[model samples]
Target: MSNVTLHISKNFKELLQFLKSISFSRAIRVGIAVTLPVLMGIQLGYFEIGLALSFGAFWSSPSDVSGSFRHKIKGILISATLVMIVSFIKGYLHFQLWLLLPVLGLLTFTIAYISIYGFRASLISFSGLMALVLSFANESEELEIYQYAVLIGVGGLWYLLLSKAWHRINPKAETEEFLSETFLLTSELIETRGKLVNPHEDHEKLQSKLLKLQSDLTTNHETLREILILSRRTSGWSNYQNKRLLIFVQLIEMLETAISNPVNYHRMDVLFNDHPQYIKRFQDLIFEMSYQLRMISEAGNDHRKLPKNDFMRQCFENVRRDVALLRETKYYEEYLMLQNLLEYQEKQFEKLKSIKRLLGDPNSTEINVIDRKKAKRFIAPQDYDPKLLLRNFSFRSTIFRHSVRLAVTVMIGYALGSIFAFQNPYSILLIVIVIMRPSYGLTRSRAKDRMIGTLIGGAIAFGVVFMIQDPYVYGIMGVISLVIALSLVQKNYKASATFITLSVVFIYAILSPDVLSLIKFRILDTLVGAGLSYAAMLWLWPAWEFVEMKESIEKSVKANKDFLHKIIEYYLLKGHIPTSYNIARKQAFLETSNLSSAFQRMTQEPKSKQREMNKVYELVVLNHNFLASLASLSTYIQHYDTTEASERFKTATEKIAFNLERVVQCLKDKTCNGAGASSEDTTLFDDQLPVFNYLEINTLKSNDTETLRELQEAHLVWEQLEWLFSISGRMLKLSASVKLD
Candidate 1:
């Protein structure tokens, strides 16, 4: 009994921590969105009618996630248009149980499936879904179609106006906030990189944590990126300010490169096992960078001048000494890796210097937007067309499956209410529709939150309704509850549900004096809906991310191979980088990011389901570091552009590309054992790709010291190339070990 109580206490504390971490700004945004309409309705002496408008107004969620202010207003416009159209037609086609079931089903499926168009489109779909359900309200028909349409449209417009008003006063607010968040996430990434190099830490657990952090950091960066792209600057600021903003945007992309370009932790640990000094030096370097980033974050948050990181030259000197020492060692591979790390580390340092110069130097402030078009055109990873929606209308699409499941569940729930003649059928269907999600884990989570939230909220509503008899007091309570509900809905659903329940109780108290009856009905309806949702989730199209893991990993491996092939070909041909190379790079990053996501989801599943977690981590780590190595070599080319392709490099790169393809084939054939790879030793130019393709050292007769220097530099790059090829070979074995069956 004591142990159980202790466990419960621990869980409660964790829950408390989570609730405390909810964003205050988001809550405030919701508050404004909900309160403005209510106040307007009260002033016009149409309390109950205005309350209905609040539901539509809330559809915009005040457009807070990301997107330009204009885009947000456009969202409100589009959503209002959708609600207005649906409201106008709702009265004519009265919904009957049998007829409504099929119609609702189709609408839910169609709207949900079409969300793949983009984030804005997804919000519009959600608005359409909610509007249709609300339009079916009993009192809705009494109001003339145009009157109801105007109320909802006005409510939406009111929220949009409120949101934009705040944004207009401080256009850089979102950008600054997001930039701070980006740098903060970068700091976290640097710390994680430090952990990766620490030999004492459990690398598997570190990888798991890194995977989860990547998901969160990626989300934060995307939101920040969208806001910047959509937002515009007013003429109050000079060209320097505009240029500074552009540099901040560039820094964000640099941060992404840092986040994605982690070295192979296992290899690093092994390499530095006896050399704690080297690991310590890198850790110190990263922490200093992290500190510099935090200062940059501070500058973004407040207008305070960022403190200069004056240690860049000192760090460089230290690295130079370390490189000199490594060069003296017989192990050429380790020397090459450390050299690559130096170059990779240099990129981050350069970014810091750029940011510092942009922030601190008064002379730098005189810059102008040389090309307004180029300055404004900060295209994100992608921006697709809405017309491309049809391409995903297949059985293989996850969104399609999710749509079908949602339609079935909500329809069944609605059928229960309509067939049995329940008083509030819409309430019942709404709960099921909102609670059911695409993933099993999420569905279970939402159902639990919804049930707890409703019960707790219901109890609180019953107490508060009678305690506060004044209608005016209840009105204030309604606003407060709405703000709490809207804010927590996405972050902590149970908390949102509780407040939402409270808001509904108080809001309805204005119309109906019987508060207890409303509470009782709300609880009963929610319970039945929750029950239906739980059942549907269990019996519905069951899909677990881990169950789909094998395919995701395979795709990632193939994508990486293709990308590496392109990189190698670029080197061999010594030609201009083609569009295919860029395409391959993007696909590779996308798949790797996807694999990280899959691994993250796998961690949420039962441990038994994770067939080869360690192997998957190894593969992910290997590919990430290999990409970094490629980027390092790419940077070298940019600096030393005059160096022509070496014959030895051509042969080594050819063999490396060939073996990488072999790895892909091995994975495809489910023969990842790293076998035939060795046997290819049918020793031609070299027996089957040897672990290390030791090139015969040809003594150059060039007496010119400059020529020797050039050869020496080329030799180092070749060593880095050889090291990456070796990593690919190891990844082949790891991939083979993954249990596809």
Candidate 2:
């Protein structure tokens, strides 16, 4: 019994430590975020009004937690200010009700297109429209608009303060958490790269990892930017240092790409092997670069100018010189590829330098956008179509399903409001609208979490209202509501909802002066709202199609083919060609996300669709794995430097070229059949296939050992290519079996 007690105690301590590491402050901020909207509703003396505000607050919470205090505050101010301005125009200028929708839509499009305002623009447009519609219905003009501005300002201000306080306690701990994860991923890629054998597999895996790293980098970029803005306002270094930390991230990405691509590896390996002194110098340069970044991050914390250390300057010069040498010699054959990569890195360093400059000039007021354009454009072809709006309106599309769900929500809200004789039916509509965010396969899970949170919040509010019975409790409860509202500022939706419910109960209990009756009505109204939202979502579409997943798989396959084609063309052209490995990496990452989302969606669907989707998903996974293998092969080929070509090597190259052409033809025709070559046509050179026969090997001097070594390496690469084609062909065949079904 004593031993058991000790074990339990140890387990409990471990659990506590884990929880502490996860940033409780961020969670509390989320809770506060939820409470703010509720407070706004209370100030309006309408639960429905509060519910509407709370919806926007919930959606914005996730971004706030990861973003800068300035960004969050700016978003809130913009949204609230827009709402106020729109409300005023409707109330005072008496804008025509019919014109409001188009005006709001245009404003939303402009804001979304022009600025880095994020989701706040959408919130503003929706809220502004809501305000305009309400103004038209009530005809209560300027006074109502003023009241809204005051309430929204109060709520937003409360959130800002609360979020700031939370961050002060934690000190950019959340940002660190994200960065730490990114570093771990980088480390994993490095470890994998070190152990890579098959160039094809290595390439595919490296590209996959690189894509994931890029995504993580993009996410961190936004987070760090937010932190930087917050730090600027609060006289803090946490956010600034975090933004500077992105330099290391960019370096890691560069190194990972170089390590993954065979052509780059060969160039580096040859340079290092031929010039041992240069290799040591290169190592020293990298060390100095890393150290300089670390020093910059530390200096930024103290609000000091970043050091213009000699080591860093020398390291930069060395990198530039090496890149210049590669370009001038055209040594790698793909020197242009190397040049492009160097240019990208140079831009990244420049951005870092700019950030450092900004940190140095304390009085500089301009908010400069970081000139890092590393984010991959994965815009689907369908997204660019002018007919997208019409397609979205079609019954087959999810948007139409969402509209039906909205209609059901409105009907349910009206029915429940009439049945209970509630003063406002719009409150129910707002709740339903807010909760019914379009989700993929995890709709049930999300709904369950929301329901649980609502119940918990409702219970807490009931207890709080019951305890505080004085008339002055209304004002006191308002202050309590503020605290609760602030706590939800940077938390998840469920936790935020809990605080929102708690805030609403206190507001209603104090204002109505009837605790028990108000509590009963509040609970009923919330249940009705939540239930309606869930039912509408589940029954309307019933099945959410896994289109994103399908698109992802198709994109990945296309990218893989492109990468293969580039590598083959590079070798065949003989005069150094660039590989589209970077493009492939970006596509692979997208495919992973799409596949994951598809799997999740499949799980939610009926067994028949789920089975079919799962089969398709399996094919995607196989293709991803095959591409990774091909990447590894490419790396090996590039690394091998041989000057002479053997007859066997020439034969292997011919076979690979033939297979590739056939594969391309099949893809062009959208066919599942293997290439039309007969088994008897297994000759090294087919006279009828003029394209394959015309391919000639570049001749080198007999004494040019380096050229001979490259030729030998090219032969090995040819053999590996044949193997990859065989494996990939089989996988593609398997995938076709499922896709065709």
**Top model number, TM-score:** 1
- Estimate the lDDT of model 2: 0.49
C-alpha lDDT (0 to 100) for residue 541 of candidate 1: 62
Going through the candidates in order, what is the number of backbone clashes in each?
Answer: 5, 47
Write candidate 1's Cα lDDT for 354-404 as tens digits.
Answer: 766666664454654534444333334334665566776775666777788
Give per-residue lDDT, candidate 1, residue 259. 51
In order of appearance, the predictions have TM-scores of 0.81, 0.56
Model 1 Cα shift for residue 420 (angstroms): 5.3
Clashing pairs for predicted structure model 1, backbone only: 672-736, 680-688, 681-687, 681-688, 683-687
Worst 10 residues of 1 by lDDT: 693-702
The stretch of ten residues in a row with the least summed lDDT in candidate 2 is 688-697
Q: TM-score for model 2?
A: 0.56
